[model samples]
Target chain A: MSTRISLDGVDKTFTNRRTGERQQIFRDFSLTLAPDELVAVVGGSGTGKTTLMHLIAGLERPDRGTVSTGGTRPRLGMVFQQPRLLDWTSVETNVRLAATAAGIDTTEVAPILDAVGLTEYARSYPSVLSGGQRQRVAVARAFVVRPEVLLLDEPFSALDELTARRLRLLLQQLWLRTPRTGLLVTHNALEAAFLADRVVVLGGRPAEVVGEYRIDRPRPRSPEDPELFDVHRRIVAALT
Target chain B: MTVTHPVGAEEVVLGGGRSPAPPDRPPATGTAARLTRPLPALLLVGLLAAGWQLMAHTSDSALIPGLGDIARNLADITTSGALGENVRVTLTRVTLGFAAAFVVSVAAGIAMGRSEWLRRFLEPAVLIGLATPGLVKALLCVIWFGVSLVNPVLTVALAAAPALTINIAQGVRAVDPALGEMAHVYRLDALTRLRYLWLPAIVPDLFTGARLGIAMAWKVIVLVEIFGLADGVGYQLNLEFSQHNVAGVLAWTVAFALVMAAIEYGLLQTLERRAVRWRRVALR
Candidate 1:
């Protein structure tokens, strides 16, 4: 498998102005994901999971060391925790804007919206939609660009279990349809197991990779499957 | 349509107790709703007018002219073309001043928002501008420009621009950093970023600043005209005041108020609604 995303010896630190204390989030941290691989990086809060995602997405540069995406600037798609849809535009227009920015044709937006089950609500404003629907639009926007790499920062964490599960399955199907390299930063062990081809645990101060698990399961794997539950257990054990 | 957040259902503020089931589709905002929406405001204005008329009848002084007396004078002044000429001059000065101020403030606000150095350098000056009253600015303008149209125009620009600059700078500062990251990740171009992210983030603030600026501009123009210039609404009011034409003074005041109201509610409000159509206003 070709390495699609690589971080070599990344160091990141933050200083608290009020307390006058410096905290390191990452130090010489390295990670790599194979092309078309979906990897979920799971860790407790403030474990630099999001910082890693940001580095891969090119939203931030490592203070030291190199971060490369397929050895060039990758066409990136990101679904943030919030919908982050433009409040001035309609749902359709938001997706279309992203697509147009990516040099994709506007015609592609409708089919993508249809896939996300938001066709009827195409012209509806973001404020008018529910949280799930809005997040779905955000997902559609990310996928509509046909990104070379997709980055998700706890996209489903805000949702209740049911909605999060539904969105997880939807995201999996969308990823399967396109087959792009993706990195998901999530804290849920079960979700990490369910959606990712590989689960990587991040822990310790100035976070480094603690454990990695490769799931060789087939698509449409049941959540109730004993093998998957075992994997979930193992991942949780790694987390603790 | 009935909308439920992924977390849970939001409480319905409009229907009371029970959550209002969202319609399957969005409702058509009908003309009837629009027309009746402002009825309460109209009724309140009508009540104020009735109270004023009642007081005018009860009082012995002609200084506080009745609405009818003001209306007659308004017609008389309008027919003689003084009203038209003065209004034209005042509006011209305001438009010129406001346009210049808008451009300058937006540019300055963006600069301050973007760069720490520029912000530090200009922030003190902008604060000084904000604290300085429009009357003071008008006085300075009159001294510099000597009763020319430039006097009111410059005063209005100085008065209005600072408020806009401050608000816009704060708006820019308040933009969600996460959204900026999203924009970068999506590889959105500068134009798209400006249109989708920056402007929307700043528009509510822009409107706030603009409304305040326009009001300031209106006041400053009149003040400058009354103090220095020999033309415009303030000058016309001065002429009426010297002759003790209480009805004319009230008439001109009403005319000025009407113009301000028309621009504020009619033009600015309509533009704001269009710009922020995506906002869900609370059900009144």
Candidate 2:
């Protein structure tokens, strides 16, 4: 396996205006997302999981340290918490948008829609679709790029249990089919266990990798499976 | 023709009693249909006319004109080619003034939005322009530029651009920062970034500013023409007023207002609908 992203000694400090104080989010925080590797960052609220993703994505410059990717920071696709579909476009147009921006051939659009199980509702607007379907569209759009690094910021944390479970099943199938390096940030241990190849827990003040677990589970593992439940419990304890 | 229903449930009959579903689209707007206003719009107009007639009756003098007499005077102006000339002058002034305002406002708004230093320097200047009273600006323009077309155009542009600049700046500032990141990751060129991300984000705001600009321009054009120019609807109104032809003055006023409504509801509304077709309006 080859390394695609390297974050070396990255420090991000944000100041609080009201208190006239500054908080160092993370100092010398670092991780690498390998090519075709699925890594889940498990962190408590404001542990700098998102800041790490931002540094990797080049959305913001870090206060200190080096963050670079393979040769260049490769194309990044993000599936944010909300669908973030342009309110003025239909589903297919929204999907077409990301692909069109890349100047790539649009052969992958149909397959992507099919992967997310949103092929039939291509003509529907985001407002008309249910929460689950909209989030699925966001997933489809991110996966459409076939990015070298795909950052998902709590992609399914907002959905109900049943809907989240269904989407997890679909996302697992997609991750298997498209072999993109996936870095998901979530506080949910079960979700982290179900989808990630390895879970890196970021906690304690200024957050570091407190625990790392590798899942040797088989593909299409049932949620009710005993082994998966055991893994979920261990990850939950780590998070707590 | 067999009009098929969705999902093999039922066959719906059309005007010809066919079973085909007719493609499940809104009916194409015919020319006559497009010209027709909704019942509420017609009622609004009727109420305005009724109010005018009632006021004229109560006034019991030639001072306040009846709606019919005003309508007749409007027809007289149209037939005599005077209304056309006056309308032409007013519209030309508005168009030129608004076009100039739009270009400057959009540029200023974009500039101020993108750069903090530029915004800090230019924001106070725009605010000064916005804070200046329209009548005061009109007087100043007349004093500086004289009674020609420049006075009206300058006055209107000053009034329009500041508000337009503020709104467009806010719109651009309000764009999804994430979208810009997506654009950068995809390496979308400058033109693509503008067209796909920025332009759409600001267009609704641009139109809003434009509508206000046009309205202000027309009114300022009239004021300028009444005081400065020797021709236009405003000047013609002045002439009617001098002759104590209240009916003719009222007539010209109503005609201009009606024409403005027509242009707004017809042209701008059509453009807005085309641009924002995906958005639905829930009328209560």
How close is each model in CA RMSD to the real structure? 6.3, 8.1
Residues B45-157, candidate 2, lDDT per residue (tens digit)?
89988897898899888998887788799899999999888888888877778888988997889888888888998999898987776777777787888867787778778
CAPRI quality of model 2: incorrect
Top TM-score model:
1
Which runs in model 2 stand beyond 4 Å of their true positions? A1-3, A217-230, B1-62, B110-119, B139-153, B170-208, B242-244, B268-284
For DockQ, the strongest prediction is 1
| TM-score of predicted structure 2 | 0.82
What TM value does the first chain of each candidate achieve? 0.96, 0.93
Weakest ten-residue segment in model 2 chain B by summed lDDT: B1-10
List of clashing residue pairs for candidate 1: B1-B22, B1-B23, B2-B22
TM-score of 1: 0.86
Any residue pairs clashing in model 2, and if so which? B2-B19, B2-B20, B3-B19, B3-B20, B3-B21, B4-B20
DockQ of 2: 0.14
How much is B221 displaced in model 1, in angstroms?
0.7
Question: Candidates' lDDT values, in order?
Answer: 0.83, 0.76
